[model samples]
Target: MNSVMITGCSSGFGLETARFFFEKGWHVIATMRKPDNSLFPTSDRLSILELDVTDQNSIDRAVREAGPIDVLINNAGIGYMSPFENTSDEIVHKLFDTNTFGTFNMVRAVVPQMRGRKAGTIINLSSSTTLKPLTFMSTYTASKAAVTAYTECLALELAPLGIRTVLIIPGLSPSTSFGKNAGDKISKSGEPADEYKALMEKVQSEFQREMLVQELTKPEDVVNAIWQAVTDSNCPVCLPAGPDAVALSQ
Candidate 1:
C-alpha cells in the first residue's frame, strides 16, 4: 500500500481526502491542529496527529513521524472574508501563514525524503479563485494564487529528481462549512464595526448565495483529483476538480 501524509484532516476536503485514500488501501497519516477528537472515525490504516501548519516545529515532527510518505497532500487552510481595505494586517498574515508558508514548510520537510528516493508526488490544494477574482476574498485568493505559482515553479524544479509536483483546484465546495466558519471568524474578530458592518454582511451573504447556487463542488470531487495526481504516471501540473473550475481556468 502507498503511504500518504495529508494535513488539515479535522474537516472538509482534508478529512474526506484522507478517508478516500485510506479506503483505497493506502496508509494515511492525517494531521490536524486538534486531532484527539477528529470528525473522522478511527481506522486501522489511518493515524491522526496534532499539527499546526503555521508552526515549523509541528511540521518537522509530523513529517519525521509519518516516515517515507509516497504522497504529500497540503490541504490545510483558512479563509477570511472582509473588504480588502478592512482586512487587518494580522488577518492577512494568518491567511498567508497557513495557506502559503504552511505549504512551503510542509513541502520543505518532505521534499528531501522524496528526493532521496527520487520517487514521490506532492499535491497542492488550490482554489478556483486563483482563476476568477472574487470580492472580499482578496487575501484568500492571493494565498491560493501563491500556492499555484509555487506549485508551477516546483514542478519544473523537481522534475529532474523524478519527483512530481501537482496542483488540484477546487471550485466552491459547498459540502464544507468553510464559508460559514470563515464568516463567523471575521464577525467574531471584532474588526468590522459600526459603519462597515452592513457592507461586510452584504458581501458575505452574497458569497454564501454563490456558494449555495453556483459553486457546490463536493469533497469527493477534490479527493478524486488528488487520487489521480498521486497515482497517475502522467498527471498534469494543474487539475481542476469540476467543470466550473476548468472553465474559469480557461
Candidate 2:
C-alpha cells in the first residue's frame, strides 16, 4: 500500500486532499499543528499526526513517525498582506517562517528517506499570484514564488534519483479558510498607512470586483490537481490548478 504524508490537514486544500487520498485507499498521514482525527472519515488507512512545520524537531519527529511514505505534500503555510513598507519585521519573519522556511524544513526531513528509497513524490502548494504580482501582496507572493522556484530546481536534481517534485499552483480560492486567516493576520497588524490607505482601498475594491466576475477556482480543483501530481509519473514540474492559473501561465 502506498503511503502519503500531508501537512496542514486541518482545513482547506489540505483537508480535502487528505479525504481524497483516504477514499482512494492510500495510507494517508494527515498532519496539522493540532491533530484531530474526527475531521477525517474513519478509515484504517488514515492516521492524523501533530506537526509544526516551523519547528525542525516537530518536523523530524513527524517524518520519523510517518515511516516509509510514497508521497510528501508540503501544504502547510500562512499568508500575509500589507503594503511592503507597512509590513513589520515581525510579520515579514512570520510569513517567511511558515511559507518558505517551513517548506524547506519539511523537504529536508523527508529527502533523506526518499533519496534512500530512490523513489518518492513531493508536491508543494503555491499561489497563482506568483505568475502576476498583486498590489499589497508582495511579501506573500515572494514567499510562494520562492517555493515555485525551489520546486523547479529540485525537480531536476531529484529526477535522476527517481524522485518527482511537483508544484500545484492554485488561483484565488475564497471558498477556503485562507482568505479568512490572512484577513485575521492583517487585522492583527493594525491599519495601513495614511499615505497608502486610499490606494489600498482602491486595490481592495478592484480585487473584489474582479473576483465577482472572474471564474475563480475551487478547492476541489486544487485537490484534483494534486492527485494528478501524485499519480502521474509524467506530470510537469509545475501544474497550474485552475482556469485563472492556466490563463496566467499562458
- TM-score of every candidate: 0.90, 0.95
Query: Which residues of candidate 2, in runs, are more than 4 Å off?
Result: 182-187
Give a tens-digit lDDT track for model 2, residues 16-61: 9999998888999999987887898777788899998888899888
Query: Candidate 2 — which pairs collide?
Result: none
Query: Residue 225 in model 1: shift from native, Å?
Result: 0.7
Worst lDDT 10-window in candidate 2: 179-188
Q: What is the lDDT for 121 in model 1?
A: 94
Model 1 lDDT tens row, 119-230: 9999999998888887778888999999999999999999999899999999886677665434422433446557777877787788778766785577888888898998
TM-score for candidate 2, residues paired by index: 0.95
Task: Assess each prediction's global lDDT (C-alpha) against the native.
Answer: 0.84, 0.88
TM-score of 1: 0.90
